[model samples]
Target: MNVSSPLNNEFAISRRRKAAMIVQMMISDGGNLSLSQLPESLQELLTDELGAIRLVDRDTVLGVAEEFIAELGSLGLSAPGSRDGAIAALSDHLSPTVAARLREQMESVRFGDHWHIVIDLPNSRIVDIMNAESVEICAVALSKLPTSKAAAVLAQTPGERARRITYAMSLTADISPDAVHRIGQSLAKEYGRPVSSAFDKAPAQRLGAILNSAVTQTREEVLGGLGEDDPEFANDLRKAIFTFKDIPARVKPTDIPNCIRTVDPAQLSSAIASALAADEPVISAAEFILSNVSQRMAGQIREEAEELGTIKKADAEAAMSSVTSAIRDLVESGTITLRDPEADTDE
Candidate 1:
């Protein structure tokens, strides 16, 4: 990566370049690493020298270098500059306060070569959309940006403005999947085919390209079949799938309690037992937990969870909700941990 960017203030480029140089030097040593391995004091001393050369605090420099090495290890290869740009781009996308601090410590920031502008103004006419307004009005008003400031700005516009842009986008010929596929086929036929390696990877966006396929059941069946075999493997495949436009209202309170009664008490007890083992002790861990929560609630959940072995439909859903919420709060507050490692393994 070129640490010297056209827009960076002075000293940033130099600092980043030094960091890169230090990383290069470390990798050049040709040493291997393992989980059990520990660096000697000599190696720690070497880090100080490298840190000075990189213009970073010793610990900061070593920590970053270690992370870099781990990443390289994952890929089982290294390519200088390929990762450099990504680092810089991520820095470029940080909030102003964070970016300023980072800029003070380094020379260059990374930025993407291109970006997209999605708009969704509902009432705006298809033909009346303006790109400048989309950029200025919508993009300029958002908070907590995850990417470049400019890109974040475009994401925060009012819903009406977004709808207008989306409406305009809808008028385009891109609506016809048939038209686009034919063109892709034509290009592929002409160019032959791309040579791909085992390392060939698809980005989330590329994986989302299946949204245009026309057959609803066909898509579901294909994806569902894969999910039946390995659910995690197909998780990303449904990233952009469409669903019903209307959402139903919530179930009644009585219905919720009935749902709670459906949980298996044995499963629930095992889960809670595990959670309690890892959990920090309150003045009286079990007592305190049961005190704030109703005994009847706990009883119902316990009964339902226990019935898992004998019956499939126990209707302990309401009780389960109470248990889940209580457990979540305790765990989040650091009051408890799952003592039973096997509890989560059951599901």
Candidate 2:
């Protein structure tokens, strides 16, 4: 297979340099080379080419290549057979003053590097780190973040866990910069870059979405707890958690059709029928669903509902639940966007 253009030049240069180094190493060491002593990448490449060649012959060649690559890396050099190595070679060739200037410029792009570190850390690992620390410490660290990043972290956490952390924050007063700085230093070490004060915020709808997927009991308990502690904040969480009933008010006319398209036709019909048949019918929801579809399709759905005559409340609820789940999935995947009334009207 042909290597991609981006890999070709660097791979060739690195491979040549490694091969030369391996030869020198082997000659110096009594012309002996061991395949097992070679780096795995070089070994794999050489092994692939050894299909027709004798194993012993190919092993010696690979052994040398691995030693060369390792030696180059040890000398603060990039592996000659990789893209990074090529970049390192170019940097090394530049004048010292020019290189120092470039390094300074690169350091200013720390945000990108910091982002990669955060992104590379798995959600579970982040949670583990938070859980391991004292609640006060965790809260202090979280509060130091800008709202968006804090929200993103909270969204990933289980509702109950997030509530505990939020509660801890409420109970605490001032957060010491020294404490935050120490934590920052540890995290910076892991990231291999200086810690910088920058973070990306998740959208409110996305946070709502994470809670939507949470267990109903956990969501309720957490919200109830938050309500007891801070009623207004709890109310905000309530507004964020959208349900099927919110479809009429939150979903835009343009997105309604696309949202319905994602739901099963049978489920949509059942959900609409059940809503219409209720003692206090969800007229708005029924209208929202019907208005979004073509007249012919709406008529057919109505006919189907009429033929069903009566649906048990349980069945209706189950059907509606399915349709709601489909809508949530669509929204989360960005197939559709739902407007948040409160967020839009907020000053």
User: Number of the top candidate by lDDT?
Assistant: 2
TM-score to native of every candidate shown: 0.18, 0.40
Off by over 4 Å in 2: 1-226, 279-281, 345-347
**Model 1 C-alpha lDDT per residue in residues 1-347, reported as the tens digit of each score:** 63422322223335444444554555778745331222245456545545545234555555565666667688964433333434445655876556444533332221211111112212122112223344222222221123454243334535576556545543543335454333333322222222344544564324434532323446568677868986765675554332211000111122323322433555445433433332243113323333434678667545543444332222222322334444434434765442332234422
* Residue pairs that clash (backbone atoms under 3 angstroms), model 2: 14-80, 14-81, 22-64
User: Candidate 2 lDDT, tens digit per residue, 134-186?
Assistant: 67756765765566766777787777777788889986576565655555545
Winner by TM-score: 2
> 146 in model 2: Cα distance from truth in Å?
17
Candidate 2 Cα lDDT to native: 0.63
Cα TM-score of candidate 1: 0.18
Supply every candidate's count of residue pairs whose N, Cα or C atoms clash at under 3 angstroms: 47, 3
lDDT for residue 176 in candidate 1, whole number 0-100:
53
Scored against the true structure, residue 52 in model 1 reaches a CA lDDT of 45
